[model samples]
Target: MANPNQEIKFTKLFIKNEFVDAVSKKTFPVSNPANEKLVANVAEGDKADVDLAVVAARNAFCRGSVWRNTDPTARGTLLNKLAALVERDSDIIANLIVLENGKTFANAKVEISRFAQILKFYAGFVDKYYGKTIPVDGPIFTYTRKEAIGVVGAILPWNFPVIMLAYKLAPAIAAGCTIIVKAAEQTPLSALYIAALSKEVGFPDGVINVINGFGPTVGHAIVSHLDIRKVAFTGSTDVGRLIMKTAADSNIKKVSLELGGKSPLVIFEDVDIDEAAMVAHNAIFMNHGQVCFAASRHYVHEKIYDEFVKRSAALASMRKVGDPFDADTDQGPQIDEESMKKILHFVDLGKEQGAKLETGGKRIGTEGYFMEPTVFSNVTDDMSIATHEIFGPVQCIIKFKTVDEVIESANRTNYGLMAGVMTKNIDTALTFANAVEAGTVWVNCYSAGAVAAPFGGYKESGIGRELGEEGLSLYLETKTVAIKLPYKN
Candidate 1:
């Protein structure tokens, strides 16, 4: 029988479809962010370990039969199989995610389901990938062929570990590229579970490897590895810039970054106050407000500002905070104490700047990294929380008079990953959607995304898209092969 309190130890790393001890033999404890308790022990891989994984992935891409020569239909079939496997083990994955990442169990299950959905979506597109032949003037025939970029390196964040994992992995596999993933140190169990499932689904040895360790060590190593042909990263803008620099210095590998955001939610006066207020509540509180696209900044029309603030504050105070495993828990603790401190620091800065805290600007209880769902009114665009990616359950509300001012405030941030507009007017909705400098604009909705549509950041939020045909392109390289026509013009 396993020890109840002791975390299960994963002494080996996943490489070549099997578990092997890390070459460096370093190890680290995986802790539950909710209570700061150990949940598991994962190999702490570094440069040498990353090199080994990269070589394994490169061989899998270049010499192995797993993906390089697989037919598109066959590739799709494998991805479909993987999706089914994920669905079957959704509960297990969700439990692990909650245990380590501190997200509510309900939200974790939804994330798992979303992961499966993305896998299925990529599977659908695998068979649909086609090379186009363009009709050109004269005897010249122009054609394009898409081929896999080998040995993709995927660096995931801890916030939505498994879901983000699916976002990067599914499309890469569908495009016939072997991948090596570095899971966030804060969460590693789900990645291990995913590795186990990959073997069960018959992905060949070395095709998909998962490494767990610190970013500077494992992440940098993977990004700088010569064998890595591409890098797909989801993290902070600072880290994204570092990865870009590393990739540039070592190799001209393709880089895809989905970075941070201080997304805005615009609530026009024409919208239903009740409906808009409720929508805005979910916008800032979902996932404990740890979402990259969480509507952290709110721009409300002055006409309904008082009512909106009142309703939004009431909803924030009503959120149930407890262990992530509890079904009744609406929100869990921040990822860890460090993150909790960072969030509180931002909240303090909000106070220092003279922003009025309507409610919830302090930690909730002493048991965990539990922060009260905070809301700040009278916030200026210049406030740090108003401009930075707080990545917490803090909502900053700002009032605006005109549509043009609202648009300007919404677009003022350096990050433009997503923005929300709560307006019943179709004309206003369309106008905001068109004018907002964001990759995704939600009308009376927040964080609404599907695999059919492409997702990315417009400015510093990110480089490269993550879903649909555009996402798949990140994993593929275009090859134009031509031969002289039988009869020249």
Candidate 2:
């Protein structure tokens, strides 16, 4: 494996604006998935560390605290400063992401750049979040004002650590809420680096604290903490459900979850077969198919299904699977051994169930956690491979006859995170886009989204939205103020 241009190392928890060792004195080794080499031994945070971080966040959000008392415009200025810092150190952050998360170096840079953009996007909203005035006939004057929702707990996922951190932190900080971030143990380096940069940007102590640890300890503590008024999580649906239950049982905290997806990509007969195949390939193969919104299920019109599958399989076969740091590598290893095994298991089950394995389905090499970009054709909706989320680089292609039929098949799963429709017919595009039960539907495109666009799920995929104006609302609450004039004039 090619080493990053710069050496990046972080081995401590960031709490109250300072790097500190965990109270438990325990640490876990973070490995580079591309080469299966130890990256660093990071401080392992548990309930005790979470308690301390939560207390600090609670104090920072309390009345008269510097973070709580800062004006919205000033808050925006701080966020912008942090954004600038991030831009200055973009290369290092990107390198850390590649080293820890095993995404391609180029993709890591894109994520870092987008991280800064998201910060700037939320920074713009700091001074723009407004309240409303209700018109009344009586002498009483009433108005509603938006207020920060105190302390927030953000549990990030390993797939896109820095980007997810930006998604949760930018909005919460923009809304004047203090946050305690729990970085996934598998990829905590970039997050801790971000916390270090936050300290340099002069954000008040405890306004942003990052803990590095596993889910059951640090993650559970953050969700159940009474002082954490709001919780934003991005991970599996099973974990999201657990967070919801914990929040309800503990303090009824406001919760937002961006969870798993068995999203579909529908291709109508009108589109160019080659172009549709390429789009479908990237939708599932990007990020080694570890994306929450990856298009796992593909439905093509019966008229063009054969051509689409042929082109898609050819493209998947040509993809360069190797070390993430390799300049020409099109795909990297899965996050770890567990994920690799799980995906291969699904591939095996698909074959046993009579699904045709079209292109690739085996481990690539003896070392690391790499797998061939697998594709299965003639997949039925009820097949486990078609139904479950095989989060690795595997695609399932099924044939459909009509738009209505595809829509029914697409929405068959409980997930509603995202979907894509490819067609030249405007009516067909609109029909599929309108009928699909997903949160975001792309027409003639796949996985296209922006910071200004609201993104989330509709059904078991998730509970609340993230990104855009709706995301800002997740970190805030509303209170009405009333004034009554003495008697009638």
Candidate 3:
């Protein structure tokens, strides 16, 4: 039933399972970054729209509502139904993602495929989520109950739209919480389409809502609203800080953020140079280097530095950079012109600060926002590229002498999202993995995460985890209930 050739269009705000226009009757153009052409004119939601969405979510989360009082197994069943619908429309969703986000068609399909798996993963937790019984003294029985944390406000990023939506929405819904999602203005089509699919799947009214607009107006309203009990955001660290501040200043709402990363990949001299080169190339160049946990910082042992750089450069040159919808394309344009300009600025800074440009440091074509897959050698910690979170296709390779030295150098930056170590010796691999300051460390691998495993950051990268059992806990609150029984003879 999934039709890859079906034409899809969404041009309104989806609130309370209904498509409606904005209160001000204003609209903004959604452009296809692949060709820099107009896709649709979307309703521009503001604070007024956010207010209505929050109210709907609050009502749905109330004590006697259909959503809040539903049986746990029934809730799981509904989630499974939603997953089935996602599977049925995966092709359409993937094509819409390609049209708006500019990721290669294969990558878009991969993201869409994960939607069902993620939803089912969380759905399994619906009845399994339990609290422990405690032994108390005398005539009292004590235990704790895990309850849903009222209304959630989810703010998604432009990159990986449908996957991120599954990460936030699936867990929240499984935990019996209503949500008001604010899709990134740059890529709102796929999320709106998925919302429509949810309505077809028969979710209760006011259970799932979505709106599109600028961050300052729509996003700010979601974080600052007093009725919103929890706020989950995935974006830049600067904006994450603003959300935290807004939450604290308003009503002290619970917050979870998955922010930026400047993760490092360490390669030892013992491994096969060919395999290391391939992994290193895929780590940074897989998603046009736009991934949060991308191994942008490469720390190679001095013995294999030259050979690794050579192989990586050769692969970069062979990459197919063109339109996203093309099946053969390996790389596509950046999200927009602003992102292209920012990435180019960092490329210039890397050169000015004395790093050697190895290959692919300029724009690819005259149209769209495509940039060359860039690599820089002789990069030191002091360089601008090495110090900042360059969310683009720019790799910085630094040479190191020992595990201790590389560990210190890799932990020098403020980010601690993810780090990778590739080696054959168990002691060496475990040593580096233990020494690094990151939330998740990969040994002999990179950027391969699962829905069953918890993923998040350490320091500035984020506040809480997003997947696995821990992810479900983020949407739930525990309350201790003690009942006093009549004294027995």
Candidate 4:
């Protein structure tokens, strides 16, 4: 049913189970980040478009509406159908992801496949996620029911469009909430394609909608809408704060954010240098260092610091940075020119602040937005690259003498999204795992994302979790029902 060969077809706003243009009929150009070629001219939605989407969502969410009255088990069935549709069209979806987001074909495929699994994972929870009953005092029968939080405004980030969409869309609908998605301005096609599949899967009108536009207009309207009962967002920490304030100001809407990170990865002396090198290398370098939980900060034990640095530098030199469509390519360009410039500015700041530029420090070529895989040695926690979220392929390696010192160094930044530790000693791994401020810590296994795992952050990193059973909670509200037993006189 899905044609991977078909050219980019769905480029307009999706609302109420139909593809429609924005109210103003304005369009924005989407370019391939890898080559700067035009991908599509997507419709640009603003406050007026967002208002239309909200109206459709609210109508579908009203009492006795088709979506509102759908049985929980039926809802799960619909989600499974959506998952099947996604898997069947994974090729087309992955192509869109690669073209728009500038991730390698392998990475894009993996995200699409995993996204399908995540939808299935949440599908299994549709009927199982229910509230509890408490034994309160007196003759009162107190039982609680987990109800949907009504229409949800889900805003996505460009870095991980498919995954971020899954993080919000799957669980929100599973919890019976009608959703209005504000797709990332740069990567809106994949989301729009999937929403079309939802229609084929038999989801009622207004249950799923996606709009494309810049954050200042579409994003701002979603978070500040009075009728939208909840807001789920994945983006920068600064933007997350604004979403919170705007949602509170409008109607005190429920909000959940999966924000930015300066995640750290540490390599201990006890492990094999080769294995530690790969673990630390891929953690940051994967996805062109665009991962929110990328191991941007590298802490190596003092004894093996030089070896780790050497191995890491060699790996960086070998990384293939070019077109995302290249079968053998290992990295791709930044999402856009603005992102590329920001990463370059940080690269400059790293050099100016005295961090040793071990390998790369400049853009790859004049075309596109590609940057060489970069590494810095003799880096301190105070360096700009080490402290900030560059969202690019720049890894900072810091030498540490002891566990306590490394733990302190890892926590020095304002972010705590994810951290990695490479060591054979369980005590060392457990110590670092326990003491580190990250929400998720991988011990010798640095994969922070899984369908079964709860993904989120600590402190300024974010406010709530986005996967597992916990993710569904953000879209639900518990209601307690108790009625006095009819008195028998």
User: For residues 1-489, could you state the per-residue lDDT of candidate 2 as single tens digits?
Assistant: 245645755689999998999999999999988789888899999999999998889889888888888988888888899989988988788888888888998898889888999999999999888889998778888899999999999999999998999999999999999999998999999999889899889999999999999899999999988888999999999999999999999999999999999999999888989889999999999999999899999998899888888999999999999978889999988999999999999999999998899999999888888999989999999999989988999999999997778889999999999999998899998998899999999999988899999999989899888999999999999999989978765
Show where candidate 2 strays beyond 4 Å: none
Q: What is the C-alpha lDDT of each candidate?
A: 0.87, 0.91, 0.90, 0.90
What is the per-residue lDDT of model 1 for residues 1-489, given as tens digits with 9 covering 90 to 100?
111242443446898888877777778887777777777777888888888888788877785355677788887888888889988977777778887888987888889889888988898888777688987776777899888888899999999998899989999999999999998998888888888888898887788999888998999899898888899999999999999999999987889999999898999988898888888888889989898989899899999999999988998888888877777889998988888999999999999998999999989777668899999999999989898888999989999998888898899889999988988789989998999999999988887787888999989999999988899999989888666676867
Residue 223 deviation, candidate 3, in Å?
0.3
Compared with the true structure, what per-residue lDDT tens digits does model 4 show for residues 1-489? Answer: 222234797999999999999999999999988778899999999999999999999999999899989998899899889989988888888889888988988888888888888889998998888777888777777799999999999999888899889899899989999999999999999999999999999999999999899999999999989999999989899999999889888999988888899988888999999988998888999899888988889999999999889999999999989878778889989899998899999989989999888898789888889999999999998888888999999989999999999999999888899999999999999999999999999999787578878999998989889899999999999999986666532
Q: Write the per-residue lDDT of candidate 3 for residues 380-455, one digit (tens) a residue.
A: 9889999888889998899999988999999998889999999999999999888898999999988789999999
Higher-scoring candidate on TM-score, 1 or 3: 3
Off by over 4 Å in 3: 1-6
lDDT of 1 at 485: 78
Error of 2 at 176 (Å): 0.2
Which pairs of residues collide in candidate 1? 16-206
Model 3 per-residue lDDT at 200 = 91
TM-score of model 3 vs. true structure: 0.98
After superposition, the stretches of candidate 4 with alpha carbons farther than 4 Å from their true spots are: 1-6, 486-489
> Model 4 compared with the native: what TM-score?
0.97
Per-model TM-score versus the true fold: 0.96, 0.98, 0.98, 0.97
CA RMSD, predictions in order: 2.1, 1.3, 1.5, 1.8
Clashes of each: 1, 0, 0, 0
